[model samples]
Target chain A: MLQVHQVSHSYGGSGWRKSKAAAGKVLDNVSFDLEPGCCLGLLGTSGAGKSTLGKIVLGLQKPASGQVTFEGFELYTKGRQGIRKVRRDLQAVFQDCYSAVNPLMTADHIIGEPLRNYERLSPAELKRRTGELLEQVGLAAEDGSKRPSQFSGGQLQRVNIARAIALKPKLIVLDEPISSLDMVHQTLILDLLSELKDSIGLSYLFITHDIQAVMTICDRVAVMDKGQIVYHTDSPSSLPSAEHEAVQRLVSAVLPQHPSLRTSWV
Target chain B: MTSTHTLEVRGLQVRVNDGGKSLPLLKAIDLTIEKGQVLGLVGESGSGKSITCSAILQLLNRRGLEVEGSVRLNGRQLTKLPNREIRMIRGREIGTIMQNPMNAFTPVYTVGSQFVETLRTHSKLSKMQARAQAAASLAEVGLSEPARVMKSYPHQLSGGMLQRVMIAISMCLQPALVIADEPTTALDSVNQLQVLRQLDKLRTEYGTSILLVSHDLGVIARMADTVAVMKAGEIVEHADVHDLFDRPQHDYTRMLLQARLRGRKDA
Candidate 1:
């Protein structure tokens, strides 16, 4: 379970010192609640401060105001001990799969890096578990020896997901995970996320600009505009009725699946 | 325009010779685009869609790659044209809008300077004339403050803004053909819609032919008159957009359509 209460943030400021010279707030009094074992979709366009919010929730960046409570523990104010306790229970999968992993590291070593830090495992056991994680994400165990350059965009993302679910983390912050992939790969990745959620009881903070992606995997959807949650819906199917300019733009932008259904003059 | 057809490709083939082995990049392909029509090319990555564009543009490295085919633009043979003449034809006769707008522009120069330079290169317009033309072109693309956008550098603008700038440039000359390679893929939803609308406006207003290449079927269905599905360096299916989407002839195309994330669209 996670709760973000009136969290606000702006760039160009460091530490507890708030700079008056800082630009306008990127996130303005944002609040959300994610129930246990349920995915929360944060839908927004570029520069909507979606990633910044993700960083705040991950405790990688400190918010300017308000509180983020994850698993009944405060992320920022409770300091090092609170963060250290929850670090292993939270994981992330980013958009650019190739840049997320080190080029010099092999797949097995990349996935095993977290396990090594969190668990005390021998070399043989670590290798076995790494292989098992790869299999769980629909990748071959033999792929573990290859570098990031060897895999395609979709395959590399699978490796990234493999690493995220390796610890069986309670929540995974997926920031535009399928945006960089093609349609086929997008379907596969969405299906894998859904499967992982049902199998291991995982929760997700799914950040994306895609409405269809949210409809496929998320239980609830929140539409963010200019760093504010302008619309909130219990389900994605009801998104079309929202009157917000941002939501309407997103809805109309989704091109029809078949040419016969196309109404636009293009 | 001198020629009725804007672009025509006949038996176009491309191959790369690595050491002693020759790998085919594009098989013999045939395509044609009339004035004010859109031809959609769709395929997976490494399926020769981009290669086809590069071959048509003569942008591919000529050292090891062999392009064996005829490419005609408005009755002019592009494949046989000298570098000097083809260079003249590139931006003047045939425009291009690539996926990444960042790469299309220089970081140091102001957008106004670049637009003026591109305009002056193809025409005998004076500096002042080109500047006025640039502002009008930017305004045509729906940029609210053309003067501010022109003064700002490429880095200062968002991807959508830069893409609109690119569209303004490509359409300003009223080129016969425009090759748009994933033009809206990098943009957000609203920006993508705006860019697509601008492209459509060009076809309707200026009667420009467009070779729209993308992996997104929805985009193709909305924009293209005819669709071509390519797989493994060859076009497997070429048909009307409606027929291709409703009744696909190829298995690969069918699989791609099926792979699209399907859910309830109505409220």
Candidate 2:
């Protein structure tokens, strides 16, 4: 479970000044909450400060104002100790799988790196656990030896997911997880994520620019614009009727799946 | 004999020289784009879609990759042309819009300088004339306050803005064909719509044939008149956009359409 209360942030000039009214605020009074075992789709256009909000939620950057609480512990108020206590329960999967991992390390080592950080495991135990994680993401045990360059974009993303789930985290902040992949791989990864969520009862903060993906996977949807939550809905099914400018723009931009459905375009 | 098609490619093949052995990157493939037609090339990653585009444009390095084919743009053979001649034809007769617009322009130079340079390179326009034309073209693409945009550097603009600038540069010359490789992949939905609308306008107004390469089926379904499905270096299926979407013949094509995430019906 997570809660974001009036989170705001700004870059430049005010780094140490602690100025409340910074010139350009990246986030402005953004607030939301995620329930246990629920997926919340954070939808926004580019430059809408979605990534800044994600970093704040992940505890990578403390917001200048407001608070982010995870598992009932205040992350920024208590400083590093607050996150360190619940670090095992929180994990993140970024968009670029290649940049997320080291090119020199093999898939096994990349997944095992997190396990080594938290717990003491022998070499044999690490390899065994890595293989299990790989299989959990629909990868073969033999793929453990392959490096990042050796795997395709989809396969590399799968390895990244394997690494994220290695700690059995309760929540994962997925930032544009399938944006870099093709439709086939996109569907495959989304299906895999759904399976994992149901199987492990995991929660997700799904941040993306894709409306279709949000509609397909999210239990609840929130539309962000200019660093604020403009629209919130209990289900994606009701997103079409939302009157918010941001939500309407997102909905209208979605191309029909088939040409027959695109009668108005021509 | 005069060919009515704006672009034609036949038996195109690309093989990378890996040490002593050769690895085939693209099989013998054929594609044609008539005047004002949009040809969509859809495929998975590493399926040789980019290689096919490079091979058509003769952009592949001859030393590392061997391209064998006949590529004709407006009846002028491209594959056999010398580097100098290919360079002349690239921007003048055929233009390219890549996926990442940031890489298309130099980081240090302002957007206006790059746009002016490209215009002058392809045409016999003076510095003042090219600058005026550049601003005009940028304005045509719906960039509000073109004067301000022309004064700013490429990094100062967003991806959508840069992409529109790329489009403006590519279309200003009225090239016979434009190769747009994943033009909207980097943009969000709202920006994606703007880019797509600009492209559609060019095809309708200027009669510019487009070779649209993308993995997004929805984009292809809306933009392309004909669709070519590529799989592992081969064109598995090529059909009218409607036919391809409604009745996909190839197993790979059907699998691709099925993989598309359909919006929730309740919405």
Candidate 3:
């Protein structure tokens, strides 16, 4: 389980000068919870701080206010060792899989890095585990020997997911995982996520601007706007009943059947 | 509204040399965009939408690629034209708004300087004349302080603002055709809507035919007069916007339409 309580972060301005931040507040009083084995969709437009929230939760960035706790322990306050343990339980599938992976390293090294760090398996054992992870994410074991450029965008994302799951993380923060992919590829990745979640009992913080993809995969959804969670609801049924105007607009824009729904907002 | 355009493509085929082998990227593609019409090329990545636009401008890399097509603009065969002639036609007769605005502009030059330089290159306009025209164009694209934006560097502006600037630059020449490759893919939804509205306005005011490339079906529905659904380097379906949205013929098109996030509740 993961809990984010009243997290706030701002960019620019520092100390006594008190200048208005050029980029403004990145996050403001954001709070959310993720139960074990349940996917939570963080839906927002670009620049809505969804990724920032993920980073804060993952301990990549220190929040200016509030605390993040996992299973009753303070994530940031526990320091490096605690953070490392937290990271062992959590992993991330970044939006840009190409950049997330080192171009110099082959897929084998990329996937094996986490296993090498967390586990003391021999090189042979590491290779076996890497192959299994690749297979789990719908990639061939032989493909792990190749570089990132040799694979397509969809394949690269699968590799990324494979690496994330190599550590057997309880939660995977997928940031715009399928946005850059094709429709067919997007479907494949979505299906893979669903299958992995069902089998592994994994929780996902599915961050994306596209609502339709989230609707298909996530069990619950939170609509974020301007550094705040404006709406939260259970997926499938509660999405339609949500009161937030922004949520309604996003829902209407993504839906193919409702051409007239967001006309007034536009 | 359906008046025939000067632009025409026939039997277009593009092959890229990958590892010493010619890999077919697009096969025998045929497309036509009438004057003042917006044609949306809807497809996922590697769907040949970008390649088709690049071929029209003769911008694709020649070493690793071969373009075999009859691309005629205003009865002039673009494929037969030399680089110099193509350069002359480009940015003047045919404008382009690339996806990444930051990469499009020079880092050192101010927006004003680049605009003036671009205008001067295509037309014999004095610095003062070019500056005034550039400012006017920026205003037309919905920038509040056109004068201020002209003096600012590309990094000084937001992605949406820079995109508007790029649109402003493209509109300055008032080209016969505008090729926009995922223009609003980098922007927020609000900015995306704003840019789309501006693009629509440009078509109405200047009668500029547009080739809008994107994966978003909703965007195509909102702006395109006609839609071409591309898949695996081929145009699987082509129809009017209303018809394509109402009755997609191909399975892929239908799947795309179905995949679109729908309903107010999901928002």
Question: What C-alpha lDDT values do all the predictions have?
Answer: 0.90, 0.89, 0.84
Comparing 1 and 3 on lDDT, the stronger one: 1
A best-first ranking of the candidates according to their lDDT comes to 1, 2, 3
What would the per-residue lDDT of candidate 2 be over residues B164-217, giving only the tens digit for each residue? 998898778988899999999988888998999899888998999999999999
TM-score of chain A as modeled in candidate 3? 0.92
Q: lDDT tens digits, residues B149-258, model 3?
A: 99998988888888888778778888899999998877656677778878887788888999999877667767788888888889999999888877789998887766
How many Å off is the CA of B76 in candidate 3? 1.9
The positional error of residue B154 in candidate 3, measured at the CA in angstroms, is: 2.1
lDDT of 3 at A111: 92
* Residue ranges of candidate 2 with Cα displaced over 4 Å: A13-23, A263-266, B261-267
Mind giving the per-residue lDDT tens digits that candidate 2 earns over A1-266? Answer: 79999999887564565564454878999988899999999999998889999888888998999989999888986557788888888889898888999999999999999999998999999999999999999999999999999999899999999988888899999999999888889888988999999998899999999988898899999899988888899878778788888898998998878877874542
Worst 10 residues of 2 chain B by lDDT: B258-267
- Tell me what fraction of the real C-alpha contacts between chains A and B each candidate also makes: 0.70, 0.77, 0.12
- Candidate 3, which segments miss by more than 4 Å at Cα? A13-20, A235-241, A248-265, B1-4, B16-23, B231-236, B242-267
Candidate 1 chain B lowest-lDDT run of ten = B258-267
**Each prediction's TM-score versus the true structure:** 0.95, 0.96, 0.89
